[model samples]
Target: MEAITPFLNANQQISVDIKTLREAPDFKAGEVDIDIRNVTPLFLNQEEINAHYLTTYKFRLYASQAYVEEKGIPQSIHDLDAHTLISFTKDGLFPHTYEPQAIKCKQHLIIDCPLAIANAVENNVGIGPLLPHIARLSQQSLVPILHNQLRQSLNIYYTYPASLTQNRMVQDFYNYLQSLPEDFLKGRTHLLAKRPQKINPLSDF
Candidate 1:
């Protein structure tokens, strides 16, 4: 929200609400002019709501250096059984293709917020999946586990009522959002340039 504040004119005012993407309130009643969400709500009326695909984000399993040194690195899906797992309290908007495999590991903790989960993993609580951008932002030196194997992707969207599409303030905000640098939206790979050396998958240890 802070990123686009400069674009608003003197007559324009803005209100921001942060909540789960699925719980985004209806904008048809004119309560909101724009609703930015990570996932498109299922109940959104296609005729009434206009959603613009913003960008795609990828997630990978991460483990703290402390945890890796203590439990040894997991090289295969079955190896996860020997390590503790951290997960969200609710299944998130991302796809669950890798969930079944994750369930096989012993769950060490469940967190409601993604940031909190990353913090716990960083504190050496357990290994868990998180967005690479977020992990890097935390500045905790987390090792990417199964980097070539397990992964999930999500697309962010900017949605607004069809009626508000022509509103000057709304359009200006939309334009600013669209103009964001690609690296800012998708994150930079150089953030992970110093990532620890990859673990050998076939090592017996």
Candidate 2:
């Protein structure tokens, strides 16, 4: 919505649907014009769908200022025992390498929507994992927690029917989305391996 909202006129309308797709969609049927999803091995094994890489995201733990003030900061994964954990449903769907770790929380707030999870965390619900860009939208109310020790990754992909390749508007919109993430992709790790970093204290809330 952030990307498409700017250019809309007053009378225009737009809709977005979020789902965990079980199979490659029949885009030729015209139920929807475009699809965006996190790349998975299932997406790789299918020949019917063509997934275009958009950008990679690092999912790091965050706590709102209000949360930290009440429960104190968690500097390690072990520290999370006392805290509530906010997470998404369908946690086991992705391969470990392509997705983030699914934690076992003492107190869990499980929701399917990423935006909703961010809002819950922002409202001082619990510590949750979110991409930095999403957390930045929190206006610094969310503070990074145990960032060096625990993290997850997601690779976003854009898809459409191979049939749309030559259509001008679809092509242009896809091209625009492709270009939008150039700056966001910097320093993001799509790689499964990386050098280790030194641990630090969680001081700032």
Q: Residue 152 lDDT in model 2?
A: 69
| Residue 32 alpha-carbon offset, candidate 1, angstroms | 3.3
For residue 162, model 1's alpha carbon misses the true position, in angstroms, by 1.1
Tens digit per residue, CA lDDT, model 2, 40-85:
6776556655567777667777889999999999877778879988
What lDDT, from 0 to 1, does candidate 1 have? 0.59
What would the TM-score be for candidate 2 when compared with the true structure? 0.69
Each candidate structure's TM-score, on Cα atoms with residue i matched to residue i, is 0.73, 0.69
Top lDDT hit: 1
Question: What lDDT tens digits, residue by residue, belong to model 1 across residues 1-205?
Answer: 3444454343233433323333454564443445554544463447777777766768788999888999889998678888877765434322333244434655556664667778888899888878887778767788988878777776666666676556555565556658886545542110001112211000000
